[model samples]
Target: MNDKPLSGRKAQAARNDKLILEAAREVFVADPEAPIAEVAKLAGVGISALYRRYPSKEDLLRKLCGDGLARYTELVREALESEGDLWGAFREFLRKVVVADTPSITVRLAGTFTPTSDMFEAAVAADELNRALLARVKDAGVLREDVENGDLALVTESVSSISLGDAERTRELRLRALELYLEALRAPGAGPLPSSAPSEEEMGARWVPKQAK
Candidate 1:
């Protein structure tokens, strides 16, 4: 009857939860509609255990996206506080986020499941951090006037689309593509980028689960 994690059963439960969540992140992002059994297989955990941890695919999706959002918010906060010139910090932030595939999580999995309250709060926090970081560069006269909040999301997602070959190869290509994007984002180079970024509302609507929307 001991519920302490020091107990073997409790420790196994914790390990199972971690495995299920990790597997869910990979399985769901690659294919959001993939069966729950697939996640269990990937995690090397029993299907019953995955269900015990998540109950439903929707629950799994929410947890995966929430964990991703929390990491993303922390990444943004780190970038904001990083020591460097404004432009340098901004560039490095974009690089690190792309490497983490943070933006790709929300981008790929949007509308797949309803987000929890914590997920919603994390998204807003990340948006605020992004805007604050952008503002710093804009105020310092380094960022282009046309750049907007949603632009970075699209940029990172674009690089994330490169899923050819192995993970190392994909990462190598993403970083290379990111350099091109970073150059475009840097100040005083290109004459006005064509078109406009969608409003955060326009983009954000997709992030809500279809049931909620």
Candidate 2:
């Protein structure tokens, strides 16, 4: 038997695996339908290496989606903790989801694949966190009473899909969706009267547009 320990080789292999996965994720987002050969090339790994790590395209896609959800969940949690206002936290979470190209995989795989596997289960934890955050907001009286957890979840899912346009367009869509949700939660002028609703300038400022040319 060889006297050399395999730790160095194992570490190198792990690093290569990570690089390949990251490259594959970028290709998948840019073109979900791209061929595996193209993905392998983009990853800087040979097709044989790609196959050794991920046996099939479906497997690669699933892994990509799971990774995307995990990252997204972290962003949501951070936003919730950092922003005092419920609506602000929610909006920030939406912005992160829309702006991050990797997170787009979550939107692509939504309602298509079952998330029961270990990887997917971790991803779904993010959804659970969102529910918990929404509950907290409702309890704090920031969000209206009628908005159930399910409703908020649905809104979140929808908002997460606004990646087609620039950040400005996406932010406008988020604000409109959030306004509609708030309106649904309101009890016909029962809550604290607004001294002044969000001004156009405030709304515009809250929405940071993508860097224009």
Candidate 3:
């Protein structure tokens, strides 16, 4: 019962917890209902270890969701503070969602899980940041005047829906699609867009969709 052996056990446990959490994030991104056994296998840990760290799938889901939201919020904050022009920052934000963070899967899953006020607030804060960014771009006479925060959200959703072969191909095509959409959104000769965008309230209510839920 040497003290060094006990210290090693604690260090190993910490490493196992980190591995399990990382694996769980990747698994949930692929499919939110991916089995804990799969996550354990990916983490190279025993099933018992996953449970020892998480207790239940719900527990693991909550942690993953929280971590995702925090990460997304930070991304938003960074985009806002980016030194580039507002439009570049806005484009980067879209990239971060659809191409960077896997379409905000954590935020998407938050709705499917037991309700949490923290996640809700985080979503709202992110939306507000988007709103401010939209305003800045509009004031600079860059974005089409008709464009609203909801319109930008819709554009991101539309691009996220596109499927193009493998992940690399999908990213390439998505970026091209985004570029086209961004061109359409730019002012100058922008034509009248179709029906008005959904209100922020409507967006919040309908963001995930029944099919996804």
Find the candidate with the highest TM-score and give its number.
1
Residue-wise lDDT of candidate 2 within 39-128, one digit each (tens)? 878767789988988898878877777777677778878866865676677656655655564435644544333333676467457657
What candidate 3 gets wrong by more than 4 Å, as runs, is 1-18, 102-110, 206-213
Candidate 1: Cα lDDT at 100: 81
RMSD of each: 3.1, 11.5, 5.0
Clashing pairs in 2: none
lDDT of 1 by residue, 1-213 (tens): 976556798888988888888888888888888999999999999888888878998888887777778777888898788765878878777788888887678777899877777777777888999899888788888888789888888898899888878999989999999999988987876798888897888887997777775
The best-first sequence of candidates by TM-score reads 1, 3, 2
Kindly give the stretch of ten consecutive residues in candidate 3 with the minimal lDDT sum: 102-111
Q: What is the lDDT of residue 162 in candidate 3?
A: 72
TM-scores for all predictions: 0.91, 0.59, 0.77
Residue 84 of model 1: what lDDT? 58
- Which tens-of-lDDT digit does each residue in 1-213 have in candidate 3? 556544788899999988998898778766776788999999999999889889988688777777766776677777777775877887777777766654545334544456367767877887787777777778878778898877776677677667669879988888889899888888864478789988967767643435566
lDDT of 1 at 139: 83
Better of 1 and 3 by TM-score: 1
Better of 2 and 3 by lDDT: 3
- What lDDT does model 1 reach? 0.84
